[model samples]
Target: MTHYRIDALRQTLVLAAPSDGLPHCTFWGARLPDGADLAQVAASAALDLTGGMLDANPELTLCPQTAAAFPGQPGLVVRSPDGTPLRPVFTKAGTKRTDTLSLAYTDEDLGLTLTFRFAADAATGIITASTTLDSDTPVLCDWLAAPVLPGPQLADQMIDFAGRWCDEFQPVTTPWATGIRARDNRTGRTGHEHFPAIILPARGCTNTGGEAHALHYGWSGGHRMLAEELPDGRRQIQFGHATASDPLPGTRFETAPLYAAFSDTGLNGCAVSFQRHLRDRIVTWPQPDTPRPVHYNCWEAIYFDHSLAALTAIADRAAALGAERFVLDDGWFKGRNDDTTSLGDWTIDATKWPDGLTPLIDHIHGLGMTFGLWFEPEMVNADSDLARAHPDWILGPTTQPLGRGQYVLDMANADLRDHLFTQITTTLSTHDIEYIKWDHNRVLPYNDAAQTRGTYDLLKRLRDAHPEVEIESCSSGGGRIDFGIMAHTQRVWLSDSNDALSRLRIQHDAALFLPSCVTGSHVGPRTCHTTGRIHSISFRAWVAAQRHMGFEMDPRELTDAEAATLTKVTAWYKANRDWLRTADILRLDAADPAIIAEQQQAADGTRFVVFAGHAGTSTQIAPRPLRLTGLDPAASYTIDLANREDISSLSRGTPALKSGPLTLTGQSLMSQGIALPYDLPDSMWIIEGHRA
Candidate 1:
């Protein structure tokens, strides 16, 4: 066996090529100690490769469960032109780069050439696997994967998430049972069912300790993630294109890279690693230096009540509240009074604004705030003129249920996609639009992968054309968030349920794969439109500050005290956003599951911010000491509480907060956590750390 290894970010990926007559490679996931021998480590952990050649033990293969072998669920399955199974035989392989490895295989009978590639990043500990298939003659690929990982030992627990439209990223954990545990999302969009991620916690891994292996499919559209434990003691985790596509002969097809990472420091460690990797390596297009403006979206402020005078007034108030971007969300276009009509009509409503949107747009610009518009380009109402003119453009058997009185356009249709792009481009080309809140309110029931591919193409083309404009992927609030869309979008609206208390969990789970910079968190109205829960302005703003900060409420409704709170929070975020955008995220564990605290640390260890979430359900009056993470233990620090005076509790004999910032050693602070005062229920606090 020839062993190859890539060491990165305190992790190592070892690949072994079996010289025996078997057509299988082995992958070993090892947390290498210093001066470890790659070959020796791999050899000691190698699987027993003694089984029938046609149906061998899956644990021995780099990609377990091949179609010809174990037969439960193959990572790659292809058929010949004659409709017979086609399996490739290994030919040759080599290292393309220090971080990348390539292996070639061919199915001569079917005239198909297959090459698998693996790449790793040493600093972030992210490993990616992908495959490219080229065919000389026509062939059909039922399914193809980027790379499959050999099942790891001591993986007795599984973790995944599931939620609906308003509530997303609800974590679900189960004991690692035998047989295939497949979690798939076929809803044309990423959907509300499951996030495109899966995790297997090594036997005893907890929030702060244990080993964790996570797999994430990078595609934004439909995708699948599975954790299968075969009867033969092989536990494999694989993710691939969930959308079905039939490639023709002479065509080349490459699956999106499947990213996997390992961590021995627990789940939060994995999350912090992922956050840093995505922010630094993947999200490279949108300049990190570009200030993420504190936006005031007019969605909850005045839904479907768009008018030049009203919007201008809102813009004035927004500017006063320190809003840098004034977004006119929904109902600005022609016949767009409700969700029912004018979806495909991109023209500005002349009836609502006699002159056009220029007056409002210019007014917003005059306030020193950039203008953003709402658009649902891939949707159309039956009452829309575009839909009437092209009835067949609606994707369906014409029997699909209407969501929000709308149907998804046939984005897969080239002509329809071209027309929709033209309509959107015309608005962007004519207006001084700096941002677009691209929304998709429904799902495509029909399994058409081409629709997703086409949407990606359209977004790519638009991005290429207007590189200056930033787009937000908001599928009725986080329905279409993945690395694929993250590649094109600047940020994602985390959820439509902006209730601060609920947002705590939503944002917490989102950080599992996304960086705080790309997660759109906004302070909504006092009474959330979705949950009807009223929360304090300070709490809302505090929760939002930990993310790409923004506001979704009407500033005109704010009291003097509320305005002051908003201003204070906005300024704090602006002052610290540089580090917040690129910092490492640490989700602190507490005895109470309802209590949430997150810390963001500057990479240089110079400063950090901690946002503490209160569900107001704890029976203990003092709660507990809130310890911090990602700090330089050797350094001295000064801690300042943003809401110091407001820190009062109903319990008697509790001490008041200090008048000024307190100085202490990082070691002391981390080991013996500072006591936080609890006030009202559903409250929040911002604690800052500065190097002393």
Candidate 2:
């Protein structure tokens, strides 16, 4: 047998392949202790047992089987020449690299060959596994998986997400029972309900406690994250592009890669690993040297009002308020007065602009703010010119349910996909647009896998053609957020609801895996359009400024005081954004669930930016004191207020920040939590700390 070991971000993943009989590979998860003997540990580890180096009993990373062999949950199930289930038999295995292994199998009965490809990053502890099945004989494949690992039955706890549109990333925990726990998003897109992730906590787990092994699917289309615990105490976890492909004779079918990461420092540790992988390896956009702009999007402000004069007036106010990106959302296209028409038309509304987008684009550029536009490339209304021209472009049946008064464009069709590529690339070539708010409003009605590949291909082509254009993935808000989409886009619109209180929870949950720099956190209007809840400008700006700062309101409508507050917040984010973009996020576990504190620490351990916020939830006479996390133990630090607010003004009786620049050791601040003001429940605090 041969062993492959890869160490990544404090954790280690080991893959084993048998020398002679059945060249199946098994995955083992473990913590990388300092100066441990890798060979000694791999020698004692068993493929099916849990403990030692093999903390996890993951079946072949890509389990290809048939009904005759290892029966249930086979990685690949294809019909034999006799129209029966065919299983793959191991042929040989080879060591590709120290961090990679390749295993090949063949099904003589079906004349098919299946090969598994596995690779791991030694820095992020993220293992990516993919497979390809080739044949000269045509066969009907029931289902195919990228990679499915059998989890240890000892992992008694499981965590996943469930939510709707505005309420996204709501974590749900359940004890591992006998039956199967399946999360299927058949919406043909990464549905708003559940993100493609699963975490198995060791025995009993807390936010920062216990060991966590997490798996995230890299495909964005309809996906399945499943965990099935059998009667023999074996648990199988599978995730991939939730569909099968029928390979033609002499053709090859491949599966997308699935990512797996493990951490002993609990869920947050696993999150940190994933976040590092995304920012450092996966995300394609180049991080600008300056801070991400405080964008002013005119979706809520203008909606369908797209006259050049009206947009110019709004752009002036946005620039005055220090908005760096002015996005003219929807209704800028030909004959697009509402969502009912003009989806696939890329041309500007000549009536609205009189000439073209150049007038408004030039005006926005003159104001020292970049210009952005909205595009729903994969959607077409029945009333659109593109749909009218190409009637067969829509995916699904002859008649399908419509969303936002439109049907999904079938990118699976080569002709339709090429047309979309032409329209989008043409628009980019013609305009000096800096950003695109790419929106996907509806779900895929049927055969979503092809559509997903088409979407990815289209984006890849767009990126290659226009490398400077940045794209924001907005799937009706929080619908298409995963490592798969992150590989193609810049930022995600966190949620449609900009109500600060709602965002406090949503942003907290999203930041678990998504870094603050890639999350679109916007300060909406005082009266939130979705929730109808009003919030103070101080509270709203405080929440949004901490992330990829932006505004979703009309700056011209804001009061003078509110406008000034917006400007100040934008300036503050710009000054501290360098550290914010690169810091390791540490989410503190508070006794009160309502009190959320996130600390961003610089790599050198010299600086820290702590953002703390609380919803209007009070217990007894006061709210609980907040404790910070991830600080140097013995280092002395100076805590200074961002806005120069005195400690007394913040909290009535707390003495921690009464004097000028409260100085304390990092150990003291973490061990003994700081008391916060009970009166200002809606407000948030931005405390800066520097090693002194």
Candidate 3:
């Protein structure tokens, strides 16, 4: 048995290990901040807010229970709700968790205690972590842990604050049979319901409700999350939590998100994900000179059964639109349709491109638009030439464990890496390849024998060999987006999902972690990648304005009038490019009851606002002169013509001129309040005002 004591008056909480001594897994000293009430800290900065990294050896930051301020001392006094400040200090050595950390908060009044726990799971060689909230008061158990991955995997723990948390080492009876019936050992209550522990190896596992709550389910990575309450009423989990594989051990290992998640609460979870990634990986962006994409991309028309004539059509269109770069997506290589076959053959397919890629690239460059090509270099099909040619190079044992599935190329083997490098690098150097979109489709699968150390060098070698080439990352659409990848690539594909409403959150979360200039959000048409249902065009326009805007649709499908509008918007974006590229964005709620998005000045005294109406609802936005955060209110400025829907509509419709107050009270929905009779979801008014 172990006993714990707290010196509440002095402001220190201490824990004791079991007297008989528990083997392995050492725990560190625990302390609750002074002036911090355990109850409040648990909600906002509980265990979920704390983090552990392979880099930071000692120092730790934790969310104490909510009480405002917490005093600091090596050993003082603190109390728990049950008067048992059982802050257990452990020292488990020679075990899997070589490094460890823990944080917990308690409050007698609210009967709440918040706690966070994390440590390296050396056995799995990936970090195994989790978070939980405890209450002496009545509530179900709330907890979450990193989901497992297919092969050897890393662990991540995501958490949301704003409540109390407590560590629960206390054992409890798990559910019996299939029902939520468990024995509450503490309360002696039978048939107690508790949230089932999440089980995820491929994706991050999540759970919540300080009490039992919702069943965990969602697409694994690269999306935003709505705040969800578990079946238990005691806890809630939102986005802003992440985990990563043990960075390929090297000087340049990164621990940031390959896929980021943003929260509905407006928290920039992507930023948090990457900031943590920086803990392990080297950040190699803004490569040397001022790095920027030479132009936009048009890959759809140029991908499938397109001839030189068809490709040139896209090239000509991109040039007319002032796009300086054109990228050729899939179908250039020999035999690639679905994920079924035709990889590893980097050679140009004679059937599609009898003249090779150089001619099209040469044609593009001749038109002043640089050429870029796509390649999934890391993955190969079993029937591909590379695999057929060198069966031994595939990752497996000599005994031939080919029994279950197809073979995998062992990047760990120097010979394999060098061979693949020769093929890929030769293609890049032979042609004037300026940009490369490196994609990886599947996760790694190394049997016990086929693996080796130093996998991180794969990217470094590829990039060092061709430093001048700008790379864009896409893993079947962003499963590979991360700072480690960003070090070499110029930008990343945000998502394959081009729908606007979906983009609002996707782009919002993506930009939070990545800079707007480095992003390539496209102004895709309503009939986007999948659904093909046309959404509010304004929504596309708004999402496009937030980052380095482009489009993914066939320009031929749009009506002449819509094309003209796109041209107009493109022109305006180019003119005010600095506003978004170098501005601070602050979202405000408009009087229209819609999501009011606004951007402050970039390099000047200009401020812009976008007021998007609710889906299918026509609403009037009451003009509120926002106290611009980063603008000079004393200076006078003129609002641009395209920014005002009133002016743009009048200029488009009546061929008349009209000027009124900053507030568009008397104007019609199309004029001032930006309508959504359909889903004018991206309808807005960009207001550039006089500083005074």
Write down the TM-score of every candidate: 0.94, 0.93, 0.57
- lDDT tens per residue, model 2, 1-692: 56555566566665555654333334456755757665666555444543442344333434635432443466666665456765556455344554566666665655676777777787666777777777767666656676567675558778888889999999888778877888767788887787888888888655666677888877778776778776546677877666543332225667667777787676778777777788778887654665677788999988998787888998898888778998888898899999998889988888887888999999999999998889999999889888888888878664877898999988878888788788888888998998999999887776457788888988998888888888999999999998888888998998888989889888888877888888898889989999998888878997997688898887777998888888888888888888788777777777776677787778678998877886766565666666776677798988876754413344556545444467788888788866654446667777788998
Each prediction's RMSD over C-alphas, in Å, is 2.6, 3.6, 14.8
Q: Candidate 3: where is the Cα deviation over 4 Å?
A: 1-295, 337-339, 391-409, 443-456, 536-539, 590-641, 645-679, 682-684, 689-692
Instruction: Pick the winner on lDDT between candidates 2 and 3.
Output: 2
Report the C-alpha lDDT of model 3 over 1-692, residue by residue, as the tens digit: 23222322112222332332221111111224545453343234212222432231221112211122222111112233344443323222212212544444344454544443433322111232333334454432211122111110121222221100111111232211211221111110000111112211112321110111111211122211222221221122222112112212111111112121222122222232222333223235434344243355555443456477777876777666556677787667886654556677778888878888878888898988777888876556776788888777765543444321234466567887787778878888889887877665544443211121223356567778887777777654555444444555666676666666555555543433455666667767557665465765555665676666776666666676666666676776677665555453443333444454444344344455433423224254322232223333334433333444423332233211134333222122112333222223445545443333
Model 2 residue runs over 4 Å out of place are: 20-27, 32-72, 80-83, 152-154, 245-250, 286-290, 643-651
Write one digit per residue (lDDT tens) for candidate 1, span 1-692. Answer: 66666566756777666653223434445566757765676657645554543343434454443533564566666777667876665444433554477776655665666677778887788877787878887667767766667657787778888889888988888777678778667787787677888877788776567788787777876777777776556677777777354444335767777777788877876787678777777665545567788888999989998777788898898888889998889998898899888788888888887899888988999999999989988898888999889989998855778889888888878898889888888989999999999999998856566787888889988888888888998998978887777777878998999999889888988888888888888989988999999988888998988898899987788999999999988998898887777788877776555578888888788988888888758877566877776567888999888877466546344433345677878888777777776556788767888998
* Candidate 1 residue runs with Cα over 4 Å from true position: 19-35, 48-60, 65-68, 81-83, 87-90, 93-95, 243-250, 285-287, 649-659
lDDT of 3 at 67: 27
Residue 356, candidate 1: C-alpha displacement in angstroms: 0.6
| Cα distance off (Å), candidate 2, residue 628 | 1.8
The candidate maximizing lDDT is 1
